[model samples]
Target chain A: MRATIIHKPGDIRIEDVPEPKILRPTDAIIRTAATCVCGSDLWDYRGINPVDEPHPMGHEYVGVVEEVGGEVTSVKPGQFVVGSFATSDNTCPNCRNGYQSSCVHREFMSTCQAEYIRVPTADGTLVATPDQPADDLIPSLLTLSDVMGTGWYAAVAAEVQPGSTVVVVGDGAVGLSGVIAAKELGAERVIAMSRHASRQKLATEFGATDIVTERGDEGIARVKELTGGIGADSVLECVGTQESMLQALRSTRPGGNVGFVGVPHGVAIDGQELFFSHVGLRGGPAPVRRFLPDLIDRVLDGRIDPGKVFDLTLPLDEVAEGYRAMDERRAIKALLRP
Target chain B: MRATIIHKPGDIRIEDVPEPKILRPTDAIIRTAATCVCGSDLWDYRGINPVDEPHPMGHEYVGVVEEVGGEVTSVKPGQFVVGSFATSDNTCPNCRNGYQSSCVHREFMSTCQAEYIRVPTADGTLVATPDQPADDLIPSLLTLSDVMGTGWYAAVAAEVQPGSTVVVVGDGAVGLSGVIAAKELGAERVIAMSRHASRQKLATEFGATDIVTERGDEGIARVKELTGGIGADSVLECVGTQESMLQALRSTRPGGNVGFVGVPHGVAIDGQELFFSHVGLRGGPAPVRRFLPDLIDRVLDGRIDPGKVFDLTLPLDEVAEGYRAMDERRAIKALLRP
Candidate 1:
């Protein structure tokens, strides 16, 4: 099987790897139909996150089950399924409470970029559709595994209400998707911060009532201006940088919420500022599995077409090029068909 | 008029000061019947927070209205009243939404230690008793002005559930009162972190089910051990420090909440750790004015006696000793009868 592997910074390659097999009683082997390069992958590719060894590259995917272990009851052979970036035994107390990402026994699904991937905790991790999804639904459904679910979690954590003025702080696929989530959750106004023309268009299409082309303080100023100088009622911080975090904090009203979905990279929050502002901060690695079922339904019903985020697509053999495209900002997200 | 002034670190003086008079159309001069030294006041007295000048102190009080400004309507002369540390015009949008501490026109009652103090925003800041209370109710009514209301806000922000386990991260007067609030809010178990024997005793009396003598990581471990390694459902952090913040985060379940009421000093939060923990953090300078009325009712009905926190008493002229008792840890809190 061909899989994407990173040997080091700037050294992404698609190489022949051994085929995956069910190694656990709760495992399911899926023949990957689609996978994609994630925004986080660029971190390793750009040398921001050092790759100590050749490691599996992607975590988001939609696939058809080729085989299932005896303990896997929810998904079976020939079924189309979507799984979260983190695998969890949904029976755990944490998972039962919808914090599956923090499940006591959790596994990362980074090997999904390969032609065949083994998914553990299959019964609790994988959600099967009523039937095989159409080819057009594949990309959208693939997004439910990570990006869309994460965006939804950000919105939920931010407590976006019907009249909430929401500000999304990142313009990546997840941030763009948050615009949709905030709107879907009934936010009265959605503001997307993006300087990219292509990303701005999608943000507008996804229900962003306003778009702030500025970054940092200027972006916060625009948000405050849009909110009548009171700042946003809810802010979804999708970029985990010091500047982004500070902007999110500065742009939120006192007693408002900042729901962060971005994987923080050395960002530190001043407790005094958080305390004095009275802003409620809640978020971590998103429990994407909690929202997978709902997101899949939305995708199937055509309520959202998150697949549009994949501005470039290629065969699994071109995974290196896909990584390069996203790494260089030439593409918003890249889809790889296996 | 007599007032308590912090002349230097660990030095307090009870000295003569000008009697306060109505300074604005919205101000009222209150002849304080009772005032108390707070845990936060010691921050400056201990030099943890520097006091560059010999400033008048104390922010918690219950009093008789001695004089009223032309525009003061809700509270009139000779009326008994309990008001929050923060004086707010409750007509603002923030106040209407139950966040009076963040009200557009908010004022901190800085010199409540004085015999007569001018309270700004008097009409909306002070909540009068339905009738003049008997002498015995003064102690409990004084508690409603700050400590009790702050505790209730912490419990509310933490979202204590009917059968949840609650951990209070500080055992000061406010934290002990939080135990009362948690019980009132229906928490099944309350754990208080305290090393002082007197504070521990008071905590148990206030409804603490357990007491952890350790701080930070060890304290969190004790809480986890008590909760079957799952952590508490709600944690109230009444001491704002990096250690207390981390303890609050580490002691809460993945989906649990940490309600912090401590004024943050030099605390800084690691974004990645907070992101991965999945705990909800919310709190600020408490919206005490929002809870004062209901708490006053609870106090008046004899349902809760938070005045037990005040272990030491002094006349207004001896307020310097009140500050000394609290600063030296000889008293958890002290009351000054003016």
Candidate 2:
């Protein structure tokens, strides 16, 4: 089967890989329907994260189960399902507490960006709909596996309450979707930081009440200005850079929260600053499993179309192009159909 | 009037100073009934935080209102009152949100070490009882002004839930009082890390269900072991060292909270680790104004006695002894009578 692999910085390739099969009692083999190049994928692609060797490329996917292990009861063969970026046993204490990303028995699903992928702990990791999803819903459903769930988690972690003034500090799919999440969660105002005109348009369409074109200090200043110098009630940090983290921290009002979904890189928080600000910090890898069910429901009800983030698409054989498009910032996200 | 002053590391002196008087329209002059040396005070005494020049020593106090400025309203002359370590204009947005320590118009009350201290923003900073408290309640009421309020803020910031497991990462008066706050807030289990036998006894008396004499890594491991391989649901960090902060982070379960009330020295948090752990971090200087009224009620009702933390007492002229006792670790906390 063909899969996306990174040989080194700026060198992603589509190559033949062994087909996946049920490896554990709770495993399920999925025939990939759609997968995408994620914002996080750019971290390794740009070599910011060392690519030690050729590694699997993506973690988001929507697919039909080709086979299921004897212990897999929740999902069966031929059933279409969406899985979280991090697979979990779901019964673990962490998963039970709705933090599946930190589940004791967890597995990254990056291998899912291929013709076939094996999902472990299938019964607890995969969420199947009542029936096969219609063909047209594939793109939107694919988003539920990661980007959508991640966005929702960011909003929830930020504690976006009714009448909240929310600031989203990334222009990628997750940040754009965060705007949607904040709106769905009842935020009175959503401010999206995006220099890209296209993303800004989508942000406004998705419910961003304001868009700040500046970055870093200027961005924070704009947010504070929009909030009457009090800063936003909640800040969603989607870009894991030090500047983004600091902006997120400074953009929140004293006693407000900064929910960071960005994978931090070279970001070190000064304890004194955090202490003096009294801003609550909480986030992490999104507990996508916890939000998958709700996100799928929203998709099915036509309440959100997160698939709009995918501005480009390609065949599995051209997966490298998908990575290139996102790496070069030509597209917000790229979809790969297998 | 006499006051305690830190001239240099290991050099504390009792010197005559001008008596305080109302300096602002919102100020109130209080004759100190009791003022105690705090853990933070030891920072300057030990020279971890430099004492550039002789500076007034204490920030915690309970006293009798000697005089009130023309604009003072909530507290008046001849009334028993407890004021926080930091005085805040309680009408600000931050204060309205219960983060009085970060109020737009906040004032530090470190000069309280003197025989007479002037409290700024008196109407918003001091909480008075219905009548003069009996002598027996003075010490406990004094505790409410800082240590107890700080402990309560730690517990509240950590979001201690009913029946949750709580771990307190310091054994100072604030940490010991945190055990009381945790129990009062309905924590099912409270673990206190204490090396001293006296502090251990006080912690246990304050409803600490477990005591671990270990520090840092081993201490966190012990807490995890005690929680059945999972960490505590809430951790109160009352010690501001890097090790204590990291230990507090590592001792909390994923999705749990770490409320820090310590005045940070040089603590730095690795964002990646904090991001991956999914633990919530919230804290800072205690918004004592928010907790003062409730704590006063508890002290007045005899429901709690925090005065036990004060093991040594001295006249204002002998304030140097109080500083030495606390600095030498001979007393958990010391009280000064003026």
Candidate 3:
């Protein structure tokens, strides 16, 4: 099975790895149909997050279940399934409370940029599609596993609702997906923060009513100006940087909310500023699984097509090029076919 | 008129000051019946918050309207009233959305330690009781102006739902009041983290179901152990220290909420910890005015007595002693009568 691995920062390879086998009673083996590079992967690829040894990459995936352990009941062989980046025993108290990402028995599923993978807590982690998705629908279905579901969580955490005016910070795949999520969640006005023409075009098509190319104070000013100097009702932070976080917080009105989905890096927030701003901040590793059922339905019904975020695609053997495309910003996201 | 003044750290004196006059069309002069030394006041007295010049200090007050400018309508002369430490024009979008403390035209009402103090935004910041309260309720009504309202905001921010298990991270007047607020909000269990016996006693009296004398990690562990190793449904961060904030964040169950009202001092939170915690954090200068009407009703109707927090009382001339008592921990709060 060909899989993506990083030997070091800027060093990528595709090698034949052993096929996955069920290791837990709740495990399920899936033959990967599609997977993609993620923003977080850049953390390791850029050496910001040290890769001490050669390691497999990728966490998002949509696949066909090849086998399941005896304890796995919800999903079975031949089922087309989507699962979040993290695996969880859905019966845990945390899972029951819609925080499956933080489930007490959770196991983070990584290294699925491969031909096959083993998913633990299969019964609780995998959601089967009503039917096998058409080839055209696979890319969209793939996003439900992470990026799309994450965007939906961002909107939900930000409390986006009907008639809401929302601002999305970042123009990555997740940010673009958030535009769609906000629209699907009934936000009346979705503002996308972007400077790239391609990303802006996709953002507009995904339901962004406005775009602000400025960064930092200027970006915030642009948002406030557009919002009549009051700021947005809700702000989605899809990029986890100090500047992005502060911009998101400052972009929300005093009584509004900011939902951040980016994996924060070097972010330290002043409590006093947050307090005085009176903006409610809620985000983390999104409880992506919580919104899987609803989002999967939306994708299946053609109410949304978040797959448009993938601007490039390649075979599993070209995983290195896929990573390169996204790393160099040549592609919004690169989908890999196994 | 006499007022409390701090020229420097530990330098307190009762000074003869000019009588306050209505300074704004929306302002009113109030003959303060009760004022108290707040924990924040000690910040200036202790030299943490420098007092470069001799300045009168007091914000919390329950009094009778002595005079009103032309624009003052909701509150009139001779009306008994309780106003929050921060005065706000409640018509602002923030106020209309229930965040009066963050109102666009908000003003901090200082120097109420004197016999008469001018309150801005009188029509919005001040909430009159249903009727003049008897002597017994004065202390509780005074708290409505600050500490009590702040505690209630913490509980509300933590989203204290019916049957929630709540943990309060401070045992000061605000925290003790939070216990009462949590109970009032229908929490099944209220845990107060306090080292002092006296403060713990007050917390228990205020409806604390449990008390943990531990601090830092041990305290969080105790809270987790009490909740079967998962953590509480809500945690009120009543102290604005980094340790208290982290403890509060760690003590809440994933998907749980934390409402903090501590005037944060040197607090910087790690974005990754907050993100991974999957807990909601909200705090700051509380929207005290938003809760004033209901709080006043609660106090006047004799449903709750938050005023018991005041353990020492002094006349305006002995204001120095009031500061000393609280500074030395000899009193939970010191009430001043002018």
Candidate 4:
């Protein structure tokens, strides 16, 4: 099986790796239908996150179940399925609380950018489509595994509701997906902060009522100006940086919320600053498994077209080019066909 | 008029100060019916928060209206009222969002311990009682100005819902009030963390179902044990220190919330730590003004008696003794009568 592996910074390769087999009674082996390069992957490709040792890459996938352990009952062979980046035993306390990403028996999907991937806690992590999804729905369904699910979690965490004024920080695939989520959740006005003409265009098409191309202080000022000088009711922080986090916090009204979904690298929030801001904050790995059922329905229903984020696509053997394109900002996201 | 002044750390004195005059059309003068020393006041008395120079102390008071400014019409002279420590115009965007403490036109009541205090934004800040309460209700009504209202805000911020398992992480007056708040909010189990037996007794009387006397890691373990090893649904953080904040965070389950109100002095939260914990955090100076009407009704209806937190009482002139007693931990709180 061909798998995406990072040897070091700036070194991504497709290597011949052994096919994954069901290692646990609850595991299921899936032949990946589609996978993609994530903005988060740039962390290692750019050497922002240390590459201590060579490791498999990618955590997003839509696939067909090839094999299943005896204990796996919810999904079976030949079924088209979508699973979250994080695997979970849905019966755990955290999973029951709708935070499957924090499940006690959780394992992040790290080897999914391969021909075949082994999914643990299959019954809880994998959600089968009503039937085999059409090829056109594959990309949208694939996003439900992580990015789209994450965007929905961001909107929900920010408490977006009908008549809410929402601001989305960042213009990555997840941020663009957040624009759709905000609109789906009935946000009256969705503001997308992006400087990229292409990403801003996509954000607008995906339901952003306004776009602010500024960064830092100017960005905060712009959001405040649009929100009657107080700030939006909810701000979605899709980029995890000190500046982006601060911008999200400052761009929200005192009683509003900031739902941060980006994986924080070196961010440290000052306690007094947060206290005075009076903004509610909740961020972490998205509980994608919790939203899989509904999101899949939305995808199948054609209510949202998240697949548009994949502006570039390539054969799995060209995985290195995919990584390079995203790392260099040449592609919003690159879908890989196995 | 006489007022309590902090000359420096450990130097609290009663001094003759000029009487307050209407400085704005929105101001109203009040003859202090009762004022109390707060735990936050100890911040300056102990010098943790620097006392740059001699300054009037005290922000909690229930008083009788002495005179109103030209534009003040909500209350007239001779009416007894309870006002929040943080004054708000109650009409700004932040105030309309129920974050009155963050109002555009806001002022902290620093001269409340004096014989007479001037309250700014009287119409938006002061809530007149149905009638002059009996002598016994004075203490509880006075607490509505800050402590009780703060506790209610903590519970509200923590999202205490019916059947929620709550943890109150401070033994101060505000924390004790939080216990009451949690119960009132319909939490099935209320856990109060306090090592002092006197405070523990008060917590129980205020409706705490259990008490955890431990602190730090051990305290987290105890709370987890009580909550089936996943931690509480909501944790009210009333003591704002790095240790207390971390303990509160660790003691809440994933997807839980921490409502912090202790006015953090030197706390910095690592983004990665909070991200992994998956706990929602919202803190600030409590919007006491938002919860005033409801909390006052609770006091009047005899559903709550937050005044019990003031175990020590003294004449207004003995303000120094009141400060000393609280600073030395000889009293949970002290009430001053002018």
**lDDT by residue (tens digit), candidate 3, B1-338:** 88888889999988888998878799999999999899889989899887789988899998999999998889889999999899888997788889899888888877988898899999999988767889889999999889999999999999999999999999999999999999999999999999999999999999999999988889888999999789999999988888889999999999898998988899998999889988888888988999988888898888999999999988978989989999999999999998
| Per-model DockQ against the true two-chain complex | 0.84, 0.88, 0.83, 0.93
Which of the numbered candidates is closest to the native, going by highest DockQ? 4
Worst 10-residue lDDT window for candidate 1 chain B reads: B319-328
Alpha-carbon RMSD, each predicted model: 1.2, 1.2, 1.0, 0.8
| Cα deviation of A338, candidate 4, in Å | 0.7
By lDDT, is 1 or 3 better?
Answer: 3
lDDT per residue (tens digit) for residues A223-303 in model 4: 989999999999999999998899999999998999999999899999999999999999999999999999998989999
What's the TM for model 2?
0.98
Shift of residue A52 alpha carbon in model 2, Å? 2.1
Pairs with backbone N, CA or C atoms under 3 Å apart (clashes), candidate 2: none
Predicted candidate 2 versus true structure: per-residue lDDT over A26-122, tens digit per residue: 9999999999989998888888989998888889998999999988888889999999889999998999889999999998888877999889899
Candidate 1's displacement at residue B216, Å, is 3.1
True contacts kept of each: 0.83, 0.88, 0.80, 0.92
Chain A accuracy of model 4 expressed as TM-score:
0.99
Candidate 4, which CAPRI tier?
A: high
DockQ of 3: 0.83
- lDDT (Cα, tens digit) per residue for candidate 1, span A1-338: 89989999999888998998889889999999899999988889999998899988899988999999988888889999999999999988889878999888888888988899999999888999988999988988988888888899999999999989999999999999899999999999999999999999999999999989988777878888888777899999999999999999999998899999999998999898888788898888789889988888898899999888889999999989998888889999999998
